[model samples]
Structure formats: C-alpha cells, structure tokens
Target: MADGSNGKPGQGLLGDTENHARVRTTALVIIAFAVVLFMLVQARFLLISLAVAIILFALTSDVIRFIARQRIGRFGVPNWLASIAALVLISTALLVLSSILLAQLNTVLVTTVSYAERAPSAVASLFGWMGEDVETAVFNSLRSVEISGYVRTVAGQAGNLMQGTVLVILFVGFLFAERIWFDTKMTNFFEDEGQAARATKIITSIIHRVNYYLLVKTVVSVITGAMIYVVAQVFGIELALALGILTFILNYIPNIGSIVATGMVALVGYVETGDAQTTGILFLITGAIQFINGNVIDPWMMGRALRLSSFGIIMSLAFWGAVWGIPGMFLSVPIMVMLLVVCSHVPELRKVAVLLSREGLPEDEQELDRLAEEIENRKG
Candidate 1:
C-alpha cells in the first residue's frame, strides 16, 4: 500500500550495490591478469619452447598427414612411422643449422669485440673534417657503451638459445606423439559433436594461416639474406657469411629487425673499411634489400591472410619481447594470429578479435556488408 516514491530509494540502493560489485569484479580481473602476465614472464623459457613446438607442429602436420596417406606397394605408410620420420628429419636439420649458427655467432662475437677499440677512432676519422669538439664528442658518445657488456649479453643469449633448442626439440617430439590423440581429446572434451567440429575447424584454419605465413617469411628471408650476402661479397666486406646468416635470422623479427640489420651492416662496414664511402654504400644496399623484401615481397606473398592491425602487432611485439626477449619477438605474430582466431570464435571475445583485426569488422558485419552489396547490385 506504500506510494511509488517510497520504493525509489530502495531501487537506488540496489543499483549502487550492483555498481560497487561490478567495479570490484573488474579490479579483481585486472589483478589476476597482471599476476598471470608476471608468471608468463618468469616461465618464458618453457612457454617459448611450447610455442615453438606448436608452430613447428602446425607447419609440418599437414605434410605428415599427406605422407601417411601415400601408398607403397598398395600399403599406406603408418601414421606413427611418418611422424617419426618427419621428426627425425626436422631434428637433424635443426641440429645442423644450430651448429652452423653457433659457429658463426662465435666468430662474429670475437670480431665485434675486437672492433670495439677501433670503432670510436673509425667514427672520429669519418668526421675528421668536422671541428675537433664535434669529433671528440662523437667519439666519446660512441665509446661510452661497453663492448664487454655486449659480449656478455650475446654470450648469455647464446647459452639460452642452446637450452631453448633442447627444450623445443623435446616439446616437438612430445607434441608429435600426442598428435594422434588430439582429435579424440577434442571430441571427448566437447559433448556436442557440432561444437567439437567447430573447434577443430578453427584449429585447422589457424594452422593454415600460420603455416602460410611462415612459408612466405622463410622464402623472403632467404632471398634477402642471399642478396645481402652477394652485396657483402661484391663489396669485399669482412665477415660476409656471418652477416648473411645474421640477416637471415633477424629477418624473422618484424619492423625492428630490418632496421637493426641495416645499421649493423653499416657499422661493421665502417669499422672494417675505416671509410665513410664503404659504410654509406653498404647501408644503401642493405636498406634497399630490406625495403624490397619487407615492404614488397613479404606483403605480396602474405596478401590478406593475416588481418592483423598494425598497432596490435606492435603491442604484441613489445609485450612478448619484454616477456621473453628475442624469441618472444619471433613468435609474436603467430601468437597474435592464434588470439585473433580464437577470440573471433568466442561470442564474448568477438570484440577483442575485432580490435585486433585490421579491418575492424566481425564476421556478422562482413556478412551484412556482403548482403548490402548484393542488394545494391540487384537494384542496379
């Protein structure tokens, strides 16, 4: 029998309580996210190994499947045998590549350390025509960075690389062993066959996109590395082989990699030649090669397969780079691809996928646009 005005206060009190609870929940979520991020950073080695293994699996799983389906004398190869053969081949190639890289890195490190003393003088000489004050300032600035620190950092990275390779190999082996069970596990985990099928489709899509990206990257990187090697040899640059291998490896990391490689080539050129002309020519050549490969060939091959926002890519690069260093940078794009694909499938997380996507259009919006286009065409 109370008037409606008396009920307004009760409603307001309930709304306030709900608002407070919502804020508390958001705060807890933020705190939990921060804790998880910290944990990931601390456990980066294991996480990175697992990530690399997954990528390798994605890259080769299809080939393994195709191999398993092949018949020899009317008998198909066993899936397990094919997987084991693939694993052994990949492992052996990895070992050979790793040994070569380690040897090259060792030589480069030694050469770089030796160049430290000469670098400042080389720079000062390049600016010898300038005022004494300018030359002195430049020399001091260049020499301020300790070469030993660089050496130690490189050595630490090398050690970590060795450890990570072992871990990655082990992870890859186990993942291959479990590959057969993956589908059964998915089916068992999802009570609904439709849901399980959808999940499997999403995973397959992810694998296809990631594998295509890696394949394109590999081709572009090799081309760029070979061109740089040719230039280095033609210009008589010291440590040409090392520089080539370094270029190949660095090309895997986006944006920053090309810039760093170009700059490093120039610096090494200047130090070795003790001339500005050689350095300038080397820089120009490296820049051109990087430009053609990164800006031209890479995009042409990748096409629209990776609908990743540029800003999102940068954010992922920085976040993972901070969390896991160089290896994280290498894996950032693949990780982002997984996130974008998974989030796109989740109703609650579709917004995140949209935010991460280059086009900023969800599937529903895309369908609507398509329908609109069709209607317009019919009207015309």
Candidate 2:
C-alpha cells in the first residue's frame, strides 16, 4: 500500500516474484551439481586416473618446455624429440620407483601383519591390571582379521594402481602430442584473440602453481620421511626404512596423512620394544616432525602459491577421499587449485572462486561495484 516510483500497488509483489525466480534457479544449479557429482563418483576409476594424468602433465609440462629449449650446439633440441626424451626418462624412472615401492610395501605389509600377532600381548602388558582373559579376547578379536585376505586385497589394489599408472602414461603422451597445436586450436575456437590469450594465461597460471605445489610438497615429504627414519633408527625401531617410505607416500594426503603415519610408527615402536616409554617417545618425536613440516615448513614454502582456503581444502580432501579413496586425497589440492583458478576468470563463477580462496578477496566484484557507483555518482 506504499506508493513507489512505478506508482503501482503490486510493485513489491513483482520484486518478490523476481527474488523467488532467482532462488529457484540457484536451487536447480545446486541439484544439477549434485547429480553430476554422483555420476563422477560412480565412474571414479576412469575420472580419477584422468585427473591424475592431467595433474602429472601440469607438473612436468614446463620441465619439458625447458628441455626443449636447451641446445647442445647451434641448434636447440626439437620439441618432439625433447618430448620423447622427457617421456622416456620419466617413464623409466616411474617404472623403477614403482618396483622399489612395491617391494617396500610388500615388506611393510608382511612385517605389520607379523606384528599384529604380538600387538595384543604388547597392549596387555601396557595394562598390567588386565588378566590373561582380556589378552585372549584382544588376540581373538585381532586374529579374526585374515591377514592373507588383506594382503590379497592390497595386491589387487596395487595392480589397479599399476593400471592407473599406465593410463596416466598414455594420457601424458597424448597431451604432449597435442601441446603444439593447442594454441592454434584456441585461436580458431575464439574469435577474439585477446580472450584466447587470456584463456592461455589462465591455463599457464594453473600449470605453474600446480607444478610449484607438487615440487615443494615432494621435497618436504622426503625431508619429513628422512627425519622420521633417523628418529626411528635412534629409537631402534626395526621397520625404520619401510616406515620412512610409508611416511613419504602418506605425506601426500595432507592432515590425515601425518596422523596415520605417526600412528603407524608409534604402533611399530610399541610392538618392537614392548615398552610404553618407547612408544610415547616415538609418538612425540613423530608428532613434532609432522608439526614442524606440515605446519611450519610446508606453509612457509607454499606461501600464497595455492591461495586456497584451509576449510575448502579439507572439504576437497573429504569429498575426493570419499569418491576415489587415497588417490583422490593425494590429488585434492591440485584439483582445487584448478577449480579456483578457472572459476576466478569466469564472471559468473567469480564469487565461488572468492569463497574458495584463502584471502576471501573479491577483486573482480569490488572493481565492478566501484565502477558502477562511480558512474551513478557522475550521473547524479
């Protein structure tokens, strides 16, 4: 019943109608996203492997470019040849590393299974008041777990991982082959060359950030693993090397990785020594190492490179970890980085990007608002 500029009684109703329309559109988008996510989970094997291949390409593409630029004499190495050499070298290294890791993992599994048998006794000894019955119960509960079945499951998983690795290798090869014509394709696809260039810039930024993150993480994880090995040796832990390698691999999984690694090391320490003090000391040492590396060193090195919110990362980790398990957890950060970068460039998705970013900056939105206000003020 208030008169407005339109001088109509139903003006407010019209505004409410528009608001409801927007809300419905937003709800539809969310529903669509959920449906797509379910499909992705259903096809996780293919999608996860593809995601891994793309991340691997992002990590290595620049190095391949650098290799292509190098010259032995007057002529630089051809791009094709450089790509081939890089692929061959990387493939061989991966093969060797995979073999070594499989061996180490096998040894670790055997050792851990053997230790499982003694775990009840070790735990019972910790609680001196617990009688033989309690010990027997604990042993029975744990002994019911068929280690051979678990080993077979792990072997099957390892085989699947190898298959994923082969797929990734093939994907990388095709990506390399396409690198040359990518610019041409972009140019043809975009009528505006400037827009095409912007697209390329976004892609390049994604690659550089992902590459830096991976490189830094690998170095930090190796250092953490090495430090863990040293501490294990100092404490006379028997599975020192295996534990170290396991730590190195697990470190890729972010917050959960360090905790799991610490638990494993502590358990092994207790089982080996049967001493509560030794287990406590091992736990403390590993916790300190993880704290230093994960909280201190890793952040310092990454220092704004990712620009991803901590909460967003945890969400990504949980989502991907649930969808694709360990491999998804390992790739969560990189995938989030890609999403943040791409979304930031798209006008419609800029708000989502801001939500994903650590700083919560809305440079695009703020600039647009400022310009609108300036134009309105001049009109006034």
Query: What does candidate 1's lDDT look like per residue over 213-326, in tens digits?
Result: 899999999998898899989888889999999999999898988888888888888888877877897899799999989999899999887888989999999998998899
Model 1 lowest lDDT segment of ten:
363-372
List candidate 1 stretches off by more than 4 Å: 1-7, 127-130, 362-380
What lDDT score is found at residue 315 in candidate 1?
Answer: 97
TM-score of 2: 0.85
Q: How badly does each model clash, as a count of residue pairs?
A: 0, 0
RMSD of each: 5.6, 7.2
